[model samples]
Target: MIFYFSGTGNSAWVARQLAEGQNEELLSIAVEIDKNKEYKLREGEKVGFVFPVYAWGPPEIVLRFIRRLKMIKPEYLFFVCTCGDDTGRTAQLFSSAVARKGWRCAAGYSVTMPNTYVSLPGFDVDDEDVETQKVHNAVARVRFINEEIVSRVQTKHYNCHEGALPFTKSYFLRPFFNTFLMSPKPFHATEACIACKKCEKACPVNNIKVTDRPVWGDNCTQCLACYHICPVHAVEYGKVTAKKGQYKGRLLRDL
Candidate 1:
């Protein structure tokens, strides 16, 4: 089973591609976790994960979900990360986490995507040309990644780089971040808001609650899924973010 956790559509899109390309069944970790209250992988199935890289590491939710999961060792396991640049040292951290779980990793690869988080409006407003370049790059890398996946399935040997250090300021740290998240902050609508409410519904973490005014929840992973998938381009982090803008790592959409 291939499980994915995406804040933006990038990880989900990648997961979809991997599943279709490899002919593997696809599952959303958030959906299963939410409905079942717990999720476990079937034994003997090849397992994999695709997600965005945050602070040079995996998303907080991914860490929480993986830690809480119960699973038997798959014949092969792999992880793919989409980032705006090189993965830095976070790959090592991920490898260690899996090692502790006693599951061998098959391969870890990084792809580039447009950095949408920090790009500012009037500063780096979405550049189609740059985005196109990133998409092309990802397509090129995916071909090689497909080959690696095939080899790993055959050999059952893979090594992943450790990811970045977790931002552990203690339990209080999460609550602190939540304050900004749950408040009337960040999101700004473009002229494009069709009010479809897809953003509110798409939030797996329940970060966006559709009240009279959409309310953000405390527990958030900043996966950017809501932001990227918004059809209207109606979301913005803040004026500061509008200036700095957001960015994803190296991988762009494959097709």
Candidate 2:
């Protein structure tokens, strides 16, 4: 089984491709979290976790879900992280977290996808051509990962960088990110909002409430779902996002 958490469909696309290629069951972490039940992996089963990199590490929601998960001894375990630039030490961090639960990580992989974090300065969504290329490359990489998983290849570690700086950056930035970047204080719906409540529904954490417009709660993953999935493009993360391009990996019709 492959459990995945996606904010704006980048990791979702990767998870779907991997599941289709490997003939494995695909599970949504968001859905599971909503179910509010512990998940138990079957004995001797192959398991995988797929998610996007958040501040060089796993998102807060993903971490919480993994900690609460109950699983038996799986024959193989792996993780795949999707990122716009590099995954930093996201895989290693996840491995360490799961190790505390007595599960050994067999392999880790990273796939570069379109940049969807448009809130940051100097960062915008990639162009259509670039996103297309990224999707093509990601599909190929997922296929290779599927082959390795079938062979049960045990990769001890994996990272976007070969040096130690990525590790240092990830370790230091993760705490800061958890403290500041994950908050929903900066989010506000614009005048274009139709009070559709799509943002509230799209929020995986259920942190959004729609009244006259939409009110953001403190529990936010900074998943970009509210911004990217908004039909009227009314959700804005401060003034910077007004000029930033929006991307959700797939068209609204496709979604």
Candidate 3:
């Protein structure tokens, strides 16, 4: 089975492609977290995780889910992470985290998708041409990842888009981002909000409740789903996203 978490549908698209390629079942990590159940793997069954990268690492929700997940010992295990730019040591960090749960990550891969992180300076959605090219390239890359997983390839480092100064980005900058910047306090809907309830339904963690406007809780994944999926572009993160572009990915019909 493949456990996945996505915001803006980038990781969801990747997860779906991988699931089809491997002929495996798909489980949303957000939904599974509340199930509070245990699972047993058949002999030689492979486990997989698919999610998006956040702050140069795995999403906070993904890490927390790993801690709460209850599963028997896994045989071959792997992961696929989606990113807008590059994943700086994200897979390594995630592997270390999952190792505590008695699961060894045998392989890890990354796919670059359209940028969705707009709650920061100099960050915005990719250009239309760039976005199109990324989706096309990801199709071919996911096929390669599927072939590697099918062969049970084992590796140490993440076979992903490791950009320059990975250690500095992942180790130094990531903690700072996680410690002080990741929060839901900055999110609010402007007057343009039509109370469509799109933000409430788009929230992966169910942290939003719609009254006249959407109310955010403490358990946000910072996935920006509410921001990007807003029909009238009503969701704003402080003031950083007002002029920024938003991207909500569409899935390919076939991998």
Candidate 4:
């Protein structure tokens, strides 16, 4: 089974392409988290995970779901992570995380997709031209990865884009980002909100509730689904995202 967790459609698009190319079953990790069902991979079936890189590392939701899932180590296990620029030792961290669960990631790949992180200073969504080019490149990258996985290529690191200072970014800065920045407290709808419940419905983890306005819960994974899915330019992360562009968050409809 190919499991995926996406916030703004980048990883979702990659996962869909891979599943179709490899003829693998696609499953949503977020949806499966609440289930009591048990899963065991057949002898020949391979396992794959597709998710976005968050704070230069794998998202907390992915690691959490990995711990929750029950499965026999497949003949080939792999992961694909989407990122705006580069992943800093994310592959290393992801491989170690899965190793702790008695599963080995036979290979890992990173694809540069459309940028969606705009909550911080000097960081915003990519322009139309850059975004389009990244999407175009990602399609080709995923195609190559699909063929590699289908061939059961067991390279520990396959086509990973790990930029400079991998250890510092993954180990040092990632912890700080997860601790201080990954929170829902700064999220609130401005006066432009129309009381539309789209944010509540778009949240992969059900961390949003809409009454007169949307209220965020503490269970959030900081995926920014609500901020991106708002039809109006109402959702803001404090004052930072007020002037930032919005991502379409296309795959939220499937959640």
Candidate 5:
């Protein structure tokens, strides 16, 4: 089984491509979390985990879900992380986590995708030309990875960079950001909101509630799904995001 956790559809697109190429089953970690289900890999089936990198590490929800996952002795295990730029020690962190769960991570890879973390300064969604190029490159990478996995390659790591800054940022800055910066207090819906509840349903954590307007709760992963998925461009993350462009990766319907 190939499990994926996506915010704005980048990782979802990668997971779908990999699954299709390998003829493996694709599962959504968010939907599984919402349903409160425990997953176990079938005997002899290889397992794959795909997700976006957050703050140089895996998202908290992915970690939580992995902790709760129960897997039988699988033939192999691999992970693919999608990032806007470089993946700093994310592969190492994921391998460590899976190791703690008594599973040996056979391989780890990263694919560069369009930047989607617009809540912070110096970060914005890529322009159409750049985004298209990134998607094209990602498709080729996923195709190559599928071939490697099908060959049962024992490669341990791929496309990861580890250094002092990456280590410090992931270990120190990540905790600070996850604790203090990831909250729903900054989100607000404007008059453009149609009360479609797209933001509410798109929220992987169910941190949004739609009445006359969308209300944000304390739980937020800073995934930016609400902001990117809003059809009417109604969601805003403080004044900082007022003029920033929103982005949601093309859905399967669009494909």
Candidate 6:
């Protein structure tokens, strides 16, 4: 079974590709394994995880899900993280967690995507082909995952993307970041918006509610789901971000 948690469809996109290529069952960590839920794993089943990288590590939701997960003893396990840049040492976080659960991590990888956490305005990745290349490369990475799983190679250590280190203390600096990043105040629809409601469906966490005016809740993780998925190029993070280049949720076929 392939388990996935995605906020901006990056992780989910990769997970679906891997499952399709490997002919595996897909499971959503967001809905299937909630705060209180049990997992059903058959003997000799292979388990995999695909999630987004956040703050140089796993997202808060991924960590919380891992903590609450009742994992079965799978014969194989793997992980893939969709990140904007090099996620140095962030992959190690998962290795440690799975170890604590008495589950061996077979293999892991990180793929790049557009950095959507708009609260961190400075962390922008403007490469036009970044998302497309990420999708293509992730498809190839599945081959490596399958090989490692077949070998039963347990990974105790994972590598980090170069220079992708944690800057400030998340506990202390996160509040300031979240205050501005997680709120609905920053996102405003322009006249270009048609109220298409694509943003509402794209929200993995269901943080966005579209009505006469869009509303966001404090539960947002700044994943930029709404901004990227907006079909009309209507959603934006304010004047500063609009100048930097607003995200309009471009896909491969959309090109």
Write down the TM-score of every candidate.
0.74, 0.91, 0.96, 0.95, 0.93, 0.81
lDDT of candidate 5 over 1-255, digit per residue (tens)? 999999888898889988997778999888786665656666678899999999899998899888888767567989899998877788888988888898888887888888898888778888989988888887788888888888877874565544458878888888888887787798999899999999999998788999999999987888899999999888999877888888867633365
Model 3 regions more than 4 Å off:
251-255
Off by over 4 Å in 1: 35-44, 119-126, 153-195, 229-234, 243-254
Best by lDDT: 3
RMSD of each: 5.2, 2.3, 1.4, 2.3, 2.0, 3.3
Q: Candidate 3 lDDT, tens digit per residue, 1-255? A: 899999889888889888988888899998898788897777787889999999899988889889988988788889999998989999889999989988789999999988899988889999989988998999889989999999999986769998989889999999999888888999999999999899999898999999999989998878999999998899999999999877867544443
Clashing pairs in 4: none
TM-score result, candidate 1: 0.74
Better of 2 and 6 by lDDT: 2
Note the Cα lDDT for every prediction shown.
0.63, 0.82, 0.89, 0.87, 0.84, 0.69
Clashing pairs in 2: none
Model 1 per-residue lDDT at 153: 53
Deviation in Å, model 6, residue 226 alpha carbon: 0.2
lDDT of 4 by residue, 46-146 (tens): 88999999999999889988887787777788999999998998998888888998878898999998788988999898888887777777767887998
lDDT of 4 at 170: 94
What is the overall TM-score of model 5 with all chains considered together?
A: 0.93
Better of 2 and 3 by lDDT: 3
Q: Relative to the unseen true structure, what is the Cα RMSD of model 3? A: 1.4
Candidate 3 achieves a global lDDT of 0.89
Q: 3 or 6, which is superior by lDDT?
A: 3
